[model samples]
Target: MKKRFVSMLCIIAFLFVSICGRIAYIVFSNDFTVSESYNSYVLNLETLYPVIYYYNLEKLTDNRDKYAAVLRPNERTLTDLHNLFPSSQINEITNELKAGYPLVKYVDESKIGNEKYIKTFRMSDYECVQSQLISKASSGLLSYVEPCGKREMRFHIDALGRMLRGDEGEEFEESLSNIKGIRLTLDKKVEEIAYSALSDMQNGCVVIMDVKTSSILTCISKPDKSYLNKAFSQYNVGSVFKIIVAACALENDIEFYYNCSGKTTVGDTEFSCQKNHNHGFENLSDALSNSCNCYFVNLAQKLGSKKLLATADKLGFNDDIKLYDEWSFKTANLPNKEELSSKGELSLFGFGQGKLTVSPLQMCYSLCTIGNMGVKNQVRLVYSSLDENANEDIVKYKASTRVLSEETSKELLNMLRNVVENGTGKSAEDSYHKSSGKTATAQTGRYILGTEILNTWFAGVYPSENPEYAIVVMKENGKSGNEDCAPIYREIVEKLNYL
Candidate 1:
């Protein structure tokens, strides 16, 4: 009996020792504690998206560090769930929790009060970075986040107290560390000014660019729906193409004088000036200032298709102006020489009609080239990116190219100034600043109320003598360039001068 009792005592001692050893291992072993440490670290994890800033460093989108308030379902009761979420969402939340989701988002911060658990776990509101203009220009960099309901609980121990089966925790941490925001060349105040200036128009866009740097300062597009930046969208562009025609004439040393008879016939097609009003015996400068279709038609016949197409190509027509990844000014179309075989086709193409179409952005940049004294600087939207520590990574752009000679550009500038001073773009003249530009009234072939729809445009540079800024204003279904677009251009300029 004594030996049996001793054996029972030994067996009980061994069992106790085994239990203690298991507890100590769980409490102190590195392997066992790793998951605990990871879970604790991940519980405090917050997802951040990139924020977009304006040129002056003003926030264009929401704060990047903002996090979503989340609830750990394993730690909360049904009563807690009922108080936090809508009654309709209770069942869905319960199901998600039961389906191994360790946490769910609590979006209603108003309900989170003095309750210890709620207060301790509450996070910043999950308003992801978003802005209509920023999103469009940023190439989806400032896009919408996923819906709260669909957001996965990033990291937590399961109800059974086991690490959830995934490597997303480490991957998410790495990604978060690499996430960066962008600073754009855009100025919010200027953007707002431009937007307000076009308030009266149903459809149109405005683009202002710095001629020296090719940085877009203000870009506003009307009918601003579904993230569409209409400034980059193509339109007929009307007489704006005459700039290219004039450039061709100047570069080739082609000189001509034509007596305008109000209308000129080419092949079976006849072209007429504005209202068929004759401006007799016009030179290149007079024709451009007067925007004479007859004179340009005669000039186009003289220059032919190859020279026109070459000059247009050099000015970035029929090519995309890439600004950022997957974002660009829509390709401005210029028909090939073969396509302009007919005299009528070439004549129509001469004065910015037919198969020619350009975006407000494209036209603005073309003006910038002329304003920069024939140097075509690369167009840039994003200036730099900000890292987690607020370090800047400046964006690099392609080198500027000489698209026109200084002499030709100077001649064009003089002709454009004449248009503003004494011709079609007279409305664009400001008392404070001298401006130079061309006006265009394009035929869209779309009619409203039996009247043909027109797209009017005024593209030019401000403080004309030493050009600094290039601007383009476009209005759809308008009367004429001077009557519709130039006045708005002047209004924008007047406001900008004050700033």
Candidate 2:
């Protein structure tokens, strides 16, 4: 009887050892080790998607860091590890403990596609598990307890969720403490932008120019800062700088008016219109109106980069002009050596592709060159009022900088007028007001689907027969300038009784 009792005791001991070993194996694994040791813990992963997005978007827009305390893995690094460890034994063992097991803090879209999970979780549960793990790992039982990888895990989860949604706009999750009633002065309706538009705008500002009087009528900035007008913030202008290239063509006296023949090759590079579509031999006027990429590429080589840059600089491409709101604006820097290689690139550069970038205000000023008869006028925000014999009682900021010749401006205007009449900008034409304009559709980003997402734009002046007002509208990632941005401009004009 004693021998039998001892044997039973031994068997029970053996089973206990096996269970404990398996638990250790699952817990000590690299995956859980990294996730468990972080200072911050994610209780519920799915519910925090907005938190993740708001943090990143704010980071990008404000250029400030706030999430340093919460260490979470970025998305890409998590991907490689998951590929190595497909089956998670921890899931089963984790369920054996407590009431229920929470989903892992970090996930990938490729892994979590369309899968719905509960949003809320008790923070106490995460803290409890984390504390117990730390205790067990510290005793030399689980070696992987060091908290190095936890920093980026949360970030990864947020990024994955954002990628799945595909439309994370720029607005941040408003803090309850910061809520204040918005004051509206104007009675006109204010339309809320799509998530994508707001996302693109981020913490940026917008400036709308009326070229006729060198005036900036609309200036708006996000986040409600007291100073630093972002409307003039110079980013990569993309292909909008093409107007400068057109100016170069006219100024050089290169009379290749009817030379805009379909696609042309310069050096080893090929140049074509926006889509390599054939734009039969047309006059210089038609070439400017259509924004032919190939024509400008050939023209850039003839005029050369040095002369082009010089002309652009003279036309307020690199000057500090006050854009109202008590702030100054500067144009983006031009490219150098290594940039002027392939002829196709030069062509794109001429048409505002490649290294060329500018502010919307700068683009307006460049377009204004044509409307003001070749004089690139300095821009102002406030139109001044004078007392008696124009003596300065109240100082208005209205001032114009002459940057071009009258004849040259006239020639450019004639070309642009033809554009609205019969070119890519026909959508911008209003029967009520004769208009001359140019349309731009810039391609940005690497995503295959985003290639179709063009940054549409329309820059022009009204009453083409005798210009009075010049307006410019730029829509980021819109379908087309003719369809998206021009319609907005048209609507605004109609409301103003100007159309």
Q: Using TM-score, give the best candidate's number.
A: 1
Model 2 Cα shift for residue 66 (angstroms): 29
Please give each candidate's TM-score.
0.78, 0.53
Report the Cα lDDT for candidate 1.
0.76
Top lDDT hit: 1
Deviation in angstroms for 199 in model 1? 3.3
lDDT of 1 at 494: 83
Q: Residues 240-309, candidate 2, lDDT per residue (tens digit)?
A: 4666777776777767754655677776766667666677786667677777777677777777777887
Stretches of candidate 1 above 4 Å error? Answer: 1-47, 63-67, 71-133, 136-179, 325-330, 448-450
lDDT of 2 at 26: 48
* Model 1 residue 66 distance off true place after TM-score fit, in angstroms: 6.8
Error of 2 at 83 (Å): 57
